[model samples]
Target: MAVIAPAGDRITDVAGITVGHHHRIDATARVADPESPGAGWATGTTVIRIDAPSAVCAVDVRGGGPGTRETDLLDPSNTVQTAHALVLTGGSAYGLAAADGVMAGLEALGVGLPMDDQGHVVPIVPAAVIFDLPVGSWDRRPDAGFGRRALAAATVDVAVGSVGAGAGARAGALKGGIGTAGTRIADGPAAGVQVGAVMVANPVGSVIDPATGLPWAATALDLDTYGLTPPDAGDVARLGDLVAKQTVLNTTIGVVATDAALDPSSTRRVAMAGHDGLARAIVPAHSPLDGDTIFAVATGTVHPPQPDTVPPGMNRDVGLLAEVCRVAANVVQRAIVGAVLAAEPVAGIPTYGDVLASAIR
Candidate 1:
C-alpha cells in the first residue's frame, strides 16, 4: 500500500525533476487596449527540466481549446519517447514561445537528441498555455527571455500561487495559481516509488461551490488542510452574483511526475488519470472554453514489478503500475485544490479565501 509523503509538497519531490518560474504580476496597473511593454504585465512562464539521461514522457490533452507546442510528438506512436523539458505559460498560443528558450538553455547544457557527431542537438521541449490576455496587457505575453530566465532559476524549491504561468490565472471568478502535491509508496511491491503533480489552475469551471463557499474537493477532505472552512449558509447564499460571473478565458495545464520506471504508454495512462483528478477537483472540467492538458514524466529511478513476474493467465490490472496511476489521480486532485487555496487576488479577481471572507462578513 502507498502512503502520502508529508514533506516536499511540490512535484520536486520526485527525484531528478526540478521546477522554475518567471512571471510579472502588476496589481495596480490598468490593462491598455494598446500594447504596453513593462506596465500591466501579469503573465509569466514555468519550466520543468528533467535531469541527466533524460526521462520517458507523454501527454494527454482534454480541453477543446488547448494551446500547446510539440504535443504531437508525444504520441506513443511517435519516434521521441523522452523530453528534455516542458513549459507551461500564460498568453494563450503566444506562450508557446517560452519552450524555445528552454530548448536553447538545454542545448547549451549539451542536452537533447544528437543530430551528428558535431555539437548539434535539438532539445525536445513540449509546452502548453492558458488564455490570459484579459488579465494583463494583451501583448505582454511570455517570450524566449522569460523561458530562459525560468530555466536558469530552476531548483527543487517551488513557489506556488499567483506565480509563473499562473500569474494571471482565474478559477471561475476566483483567482487561481500554481499548486503542487506529492506521495511516496511506503510499504508494498511498489515501495520507494514516488508520485507528484504540479498544476497551473485557470479552469473555466469553479473550484468553489457557492452553496458552501468551500472548494469542491473539500467534500471528501478536511478544509483545515487548506486553511479553509465552511462559510455560513446565509452568507454563501448572498454571494450569488459572483458565482454567476465565471471567467471564460481559461485552461488548467499541469504535469504529473513519478520516480518509478515507466514507458511512454504507461506514462500516457498516468497523464489520463491526472485529468480524472482534475474533474474531481473542479466543477465542469475539460470544457470547450478551457484548454486542460496534463503531461506525465517518469524519471525511472525505481523499478516497478515487471510484467514477466506476474503469473500467466492472470489479469495485469492489479500491479504496481495500477497503483501509480491511482496515486497520480489523487495527487493531481490535491494539487488543483492547493492551487485555488494558495492563490492571491490579482487583476481585481478574488481568491477562494477572499470569497470565504466575504461570506463570513
Candidate 2:
C-alpha cells in the first residue's frame, strides 16, 4: 500500500502556493447595529495566489446560488489554460470586486499572461463569493481593498479559524471559520506529490450530526484525532437550540491544490472530486441557498506518474489520477472538520468547541 501522511497542515504545503486573509469582526457592543460605523463588518476576503507565475486551474460550483467571476475562462476548452490567483470571499456578488484588486496586484508584480511587449499583462484571477451579509451590516461586506490587503499579506503560514472569509461564517447551528490540511504521497508511483485544501465552512446544512452533537463524518473517518466524542444530552440540546436560530442563508468556498503536473481537464476532475469531501463533512450539502465552490490548482512542480507497464490496461498504477482525486477528497473533508474545530463564536453564536466544552459538567 502507498503511504500518505499529513504535511504542514495547510494548503501552502503545496509548493508554489501561498494564502492570505483579511477580515473585519463585528463588535460585541455593536452587533447588528446598522447605525454604527463599520458595525456590521464581520466579513472578509481570502486570496489563494499561485506563486509560480501561473498554474493550471479549474473550478467546481455545486451550490445553486454561486456568486462568481471569471469562472468561464477556466474551462478546459477556453483560451486561458492557467490562472494567476483565486479569490474566496464574503459579500456575495459585491465581493466579486475583490478579484479586481488581485489582478492589479499581480499586474504590479509582473505576473500574468503577456498581452503586449509594452509591459501590459492581464492577470487571470477567478473568484467566488459566499453570502455573509446577514452576519453583519449588509453593506459592510468585503471590497477591492479587502482583496488588496489580503494579497499583500499572502504567506505560507496560514492562520485558521475566525479570519478571512470565514470570519462571520456559520456551520448549521455552530460558528464557522477557515481550516486547512495537506497530504504528501510517499512510497508510491506518485511519491513526493503534495495535496492540500483550505476551506471556509459556512454551510446552510449542519456539519454536526444532531443525534450525536458531532460531525457526521467523524466516526467513519476516525476523526477522534480532533478530540471530539459523542456529545451528551446537554450538548445535543444546546446544538438544537442554535440550529433553530440559524436561518441565514450562506455558503462554503475553498481551494484544493496539488504539486502534481496535470492539465486543465485533469485539474477539473480534481476539483470535482473535492466536493465529495464537502458532502462528507456537511449535511445536506449543495443546498439551493448555498453557493459551494471549490477551485483546484496544479502547480506542476512534480511530474505525474506514468504507466510503468506496457499495454497500460494491465497495470495497477494506471489509476494514478484516481489516487490524486481520492487524496483531494480526503484532504477537503479534513479541512472542513478543521474549520469547524478552529472556529470562534460570532455575534452570540457558540462555536463547536464552546458547546463541547460547556457540556463537560
Candidate 3:
C-alpha cells in the first residue's frame, strides 16, 4: 500500500494557492459610516483561487443575514456546478456584484458549468461582505472592474492584512477590516492534508483580549491594539441593543481548505468542521448581523488516502487534522483581529490594536 504524501503550508494539497486584490475607490470617495465618519472612504475586492483537479466543491454557511451570490450551486443536489473563484469585498451586499467581472474572466477561459441555448455560462462564484456602516460618508459598492482586477491578480502566493477588501475596513473601536491566513497538517484525515485558512475580519462589536479584559498582554496602548475576547455572558442582556445599532464595525468572512482527496459530501464535512475553528477563535461569532461563511476546496492534483482506507500509523494522522483544524481556526480568528488592528483608521473607526494588542505566537 502506498503511503499518503504530506503537504505543508508552502506545498500541496492545494498547490498554486494564490490571492489577489483590487482597490476600486479610495476611502474618502465612499463610506459605510455617516455618523462617526471614517478617515478613508473607498471600495475594494479580495479574490481567493484554488486550482484543483475537477470542479467539485462544498460549503457551510451559518449567518442570519448573509450577502452572497452563487452559493446555491454548492449544494450536492445541483448538477450545474463548477466553482473557480471566490470574492471577498467591502460593499456589504453591494459587493456581490463584483462577481460579474470574475464571471467575465472565468468565461473567457471557458470555465464554469455547461450553458443552455442562451449561452448563459453559470460561473460558480461565492462571495461575502462586511458592513461599512461606520465609514458612513461615501457611496459604497463593488463593480465589475474590481472583480476583474481581483481575478486577474490571483496567484498561489497570497499576502495577508490591510489589503484588498480590508482596505478602508474597520473592527472594534480601532481601524479595522482586512484579510489574514494560516495553514497546518495532521496524521489521519489530517496527514498528507495541508489545511489552510484565509479570512477578512469586520465585526459589529468591541474587541478585547481573551487573556485579559484590557485587550492584549496587559493593556494595549497602540492605536491598533487587537487581541482575543469572547463576548461576556453578562452582555447577553444587551443583545437587543447591539443588534439595533447595525453599524459598519461588523462581521468577518473566511474560507478554510485542505488538499484532501474528498468528494463534495466529504468536503462539506470539512467545511462544516470550520465552525469549531470559528467558535474557538471568534467571540460572539455567527451573529444575526454577521455573515460567517467558510469554503472548502480539494485540489486533486495530489492524491491521498480515502476515508475508508484505515491502516496502522494512521491514528496519529487523524490527530494531525484535528490539530490542524484547531490551529487553522485560531489563525483565522487572529486574522480577523489583525484585520481590525492593521487597517489605517477610516472615518473614526477604532482598531484592534487600539482595542487590544496581538498575542500571536
Query: Residue 62 lDDT in model 3?
Result: 83
* Local distance difference test values of all predictions, in order: 0.83, 0.82, 0.59
- Top model by lDDT, which number? 1
lDDT, residue 358, model 1: 45
Over 4 Å off in model 1, which ranges? 1-6, 31-39, 52-54, 304-318, 358-361
Scored by lDDT, model 2 comes in at 0.82
Deviation from native of the Cα of residue 83 in model 1, angstroms: 0.5
In model 2, how large is the Cα lDDT of residue 148?
A: 88
Q: TM-score per candidate, in order?
A: 0.91, 0.91, 0.75
Q: For model 3, how does the per-residue alpha-carbon lDDT over 259-342 read when each residue is reduced to its tens digit?
A: 655556656666777766565455666888677777766554434454765587654235434554555565555555445445
Rank by TM-score (best first): 2, 1, 3
lDDT (Cα, tens digit) per residue for candidate 1, span 1-361:
1112246677998988998999988766443333442348888999998884748999999999999998999999999999989999998998888888999898999889999999899999999999888887778889999999999999888888888988888887788888889888776667779999999999888877776787674743456566665677665764457777564767999999999887788889999999999999888899998899999998888885545567778545347778888889988988988887778777777676665674322
lDDT of 2 by residue, 13-109 (tens): 8878888998888565133433443345788899998976447899999999899998898899988888888999988899999988899888999
Q: What is the C-alpha RMSD of each candidate to the true structure, in Å?
A: 4.3, 4.5, 7.9
Worst 10 residues of 1 by lDDT: 29-38
- Candidate 3 structure lDDT: 0.59
Task: Return the candidate ranking by lDDT, descending.
Answer: 1, 2, 3
